[model samples]
Target chain A: MAVTRETLLAFLSKKTRADLSKIEDGAELFSSGVVDSFVMVDLMMWLEKQTGARLNPADVNLDNFDSVQRILAYAASRAR
Target chain B: MSGKPGIVVLGSPRSGTTLLRRLLDAHPNIACPPETYLLSAAARFLHADQFAAGLRIGVLDGLSFAGFEEAEVLARLRGLTFGFLRDYAERVGKPRWAEKTAFDAFHLAEIRRLCEGHVKFICIQRHGLDVAVSLRDLVDKTGGYVQELHDYVRRYPEPLEAMARAWIDTATAIAELADSSEDAISLRYEDLSADPAAQMQRVFEFLDEPWDDELVGRALAGTGQVGFGDWKTYARSSVDRSSVDRWRSLPEPVQVKLAQICNPTLERLGYARIESDDDEDDADAARRRYEFGLLLNRMKNEDS
Candidate 1:
């Protein structure tokens, strides 16, 4: 099952309690203080379930998971 | 003139050594460097099985072959290591130096010989369960101190069990050292954090140093944050009881496991064994603890 952008956005929106419209697909989450590292751990775990692969600690960096676009790319790469 | 008896602070990692180091460093007569691993390294060289593979001899024998007698080796090693610390003290206009290093408890006999019987140890012990919890959180979050913990991990495999074993081993070493040596003193982390001034005064009395409110204030202020130790101390201004029994927030299973691993040593050290029977809310409590730990990390990052 592919992780849809909308689904990821919905998860982030619920975690941040922000409107879906406020968060950009390309906007930085942790770097911008929009989402904390704790939420990032939750998101990584959620992504692991969605992607069916254990996310490598090396791959779990700010550059890869800072935005929805980057996270989706990471998930898609793992799916491949 | 022969130097004064040296002070060495011994404790397992995360057992409030950082707070203790800063407090000792604050004293006008003593200079305590942050997280000096020199003593542990000295202990290793003296006791560890280091062989010269090609030469088919022990490393100490090889050193002997290379014209360094065991006594001379220790004398030089002590001079070279503690020499730097003494210089650090003098540079700062202090007369004495103390070193707080991890794993220093494991080889107290060697440390005693290395320091040529002119050393005093202040061993700090904390509750075993709380130490396991703190060690787990520290490894999970920062990926720091892995090298120091790797040997225990290899033996125990289970992370909490490894941490519990570390706490037990350190406490046992400290107890034996205190029993065998007159210069060694032990203190509890709970008591120190709860009433820092009183505990510090006791420490001063043990050291035969002058003590007063002014020294205690400087220690509590904890100004210098130089070397590699306890990033948390850099955020807080003074020690508090906030971290005394952190194991209570962890799941019952974890508490029980840690308690079981170190109960004998814990009881020996006057810490009550944990009685965690509540099972219904273990999962909920663990989740809350996890989130709280994360929130704390976030807050600390923000503060710094």
Candidate 2:
């Protein structure tokens, strides 16, 4: 169940109106103005459901969920 | 007065003020500028000269002063600020003008002095913890550093408490100034969320405007272009009512520090002292606090 970049991108695409093509794997979501606080909750819920992983506030750091690639990586790590 | 009544919607950030502003703006007779912060910034300038330097560029159009009489400068500044608001309103094609600004809550005296008999104030209140959670969510979504968020909480302390204490403080302070002024009303975010139509009708009544059901309905339906885009994936299905006590959800040490810092104001606003097991009493005290506020308003009117 290793999450791939395409799967993460598709999930994000389905959830938001953002142009995912512009969202680079390493770009900062907040600095890039691609997301805001209200959307973060929805994203977390979607991720939890999709990957069957529970995320706590402490777990909500840049390493695991900064961008699509990072999210996929985080999900893959959890799956392993 | 040459036009419809001017309204000032005041609250702390993330207190549902923006949503309320949009709702009020939906009224055909009303127009609001986004977070003008004129009076608030002026207060900060009066207290701290350094802030004036930064604010002059963004808000004061590069205005300068080289040691003029403080009172005279403030008076002149007030006039300039009011002029800006009035002119903006005129340009917007609406006779009634409103401004939604957070810092304005901290500058009640200046607001009263400037607007005087001219403007009405709408105070919007949301639970402070909810606001903090919202702020946390915002910082996370925006990819702000956790360290920065921790720093802000450490600096502002009680002023940053999520429940409506700051809103209540500002409203109470303004209410004190607005005694017999006939130009201030307080609205709760919970009531509005529970029943928008009823709450809106009350808002219109308080503002002395005719209620338009259709306009209110449209505003409720219109989320605007906000909270869209990539962020939409992160939207919470609904705000967590229980999150109002999110300070409890923080690490024990963080919660202890926040409680210690916030206890005095929290007690002043009728929040229970945040011991480990004060949840039920805290909620009750919060409810009583708002009830006393309504009572205070009634008592003031009776005295008047």
Candidate 3:
């Protein structure tokens, strides 16, 4: 199944201590300091495990993983 | 002398010391251990070996010199520490090495003497309220907030207050020491967070190492979990810049208690007193000054 933005957001809200209410689909996560370096690692690992998607170090850039929408798109691209 | 320049990253615990260590370690020219509380251990060992022995065993993972004479113990420990650095550098294939430990701040004089002019120090500072909140959060997560805080207070008697005082004191000490030597730099965690690439570039320049743009970009991208455990789902929450006014966030009764307890140290550190306009009738600026004076005297006596 292609990962949807809602699915990613739901998983993130449950997994993280962060209040994701303000996090829109295309918001900048790191730039906003909503997610720090350590949490980014956790989010990536969760995405991989939950979706069976393998993410390379190069693919972990802020451009790809900066927001729920972007992350979902990256995962969808990998699935395709 | 044996390899490249050695760096020491020192700060209060939970003040982004480990993160700075990891960031610098990601640099190609530098190497650092996972974490070491050596300097703090050294201070405790000098003051009271028994207490230091327990800390060494518990926190340092059985690294101790409990049953030896002071000079012999210090020499042995220093040798072991330097040897570990050398081996770590060789293993990592790096010419420069760095080590992070909060306790090192307490024993800056001793660390300087031991490194024998081979070390550069990077001191990290974070807002005290955030530090306190982070500590509380970790304790709650680990399921031992009360017990841990109680144990910490039992050991240190005034861990939070002492920690706040130490943060200012250590920073002042390092700043003073650095005035005479070109071997230290202080960086605020907030500033580092706000502008990581620029801050990291300054860090590399300070160490006289070549900056690797790719590594910096990767470090900025951050390593996704190599594996998972308790911290697997941990997400860095966005901090409200205005949250530094944590004094106003607590209940009135708690705020009063905190003000009473931490007023002297807070004033000493130049933090303005939190006074409610509604309660201006009860505020005593004169008494606060007198109490601050007394606290300063007490601190001087303890230091001497």
Give per-candidate clash totals.
0, 13, 2
Task: Compose the digit string of candidate 2's lDDT tens values, residues B1-304.
Answer: 3466578876655566766776787787777666676776665554433364465332223233454554566568767776777787778776777777755666666566556566777876555555555665665676743332444456555434533344345545644554455677766666666776788888889987888768755665555434322233123233224434555445333455556555654455445766642132255434543443354344334435
Could you tell me which residue pairs clash in candidate 3? Answer: A41-B224, B40-B103
Per-residue lDDT of model 3, residues A1-80, tens digit only: 56776777766664455568667788887557676544455466556656676666456565677677788788888874
Which has the greatest TM-score? 1
DockQ of predicted model 2: 0.01
The per-prediction CA RMSD against the true structure, in angstroms, equals: 12.2, 18.6, 20.5
The model with the greater TM-score, 1 or 2, is 1
B89-150: candidate 3 lDDT, tens digit per residue:
77879877788764466676667655546678787766554555555455567665333245
Q: How many backbone clashes are present in model 3?
A: 2
Q: Over 4 Å off in model 3, which ranges?
A: A1-80, B42-76, B106-109, B143-152, B155-181, B220-248, B252-304
Model 3: docking quality category? incorrect
TM-score of 1: 0.68
TM-score of chain B of each: 0.83, 0.62, 0.63
Model 1 lDDT at residue A22: 59
For model 2 chain B, give the 10-residue run with minimal summed lDDT: B227-236
* Stretches of model 1 off by over 4 angstroms after superposition: A1-80, B50-57, B65-67, B106-109, B276-304
RMSD over all Cα atoms, model 2: 18.6
Question: Where does candidate 2 stray beyond 4 Å?
Answer: A1-80, B1-5, B48-75, B107-109, B141-181, B223-304
Models sorted by lDDT, best on top: 1, 3, 2
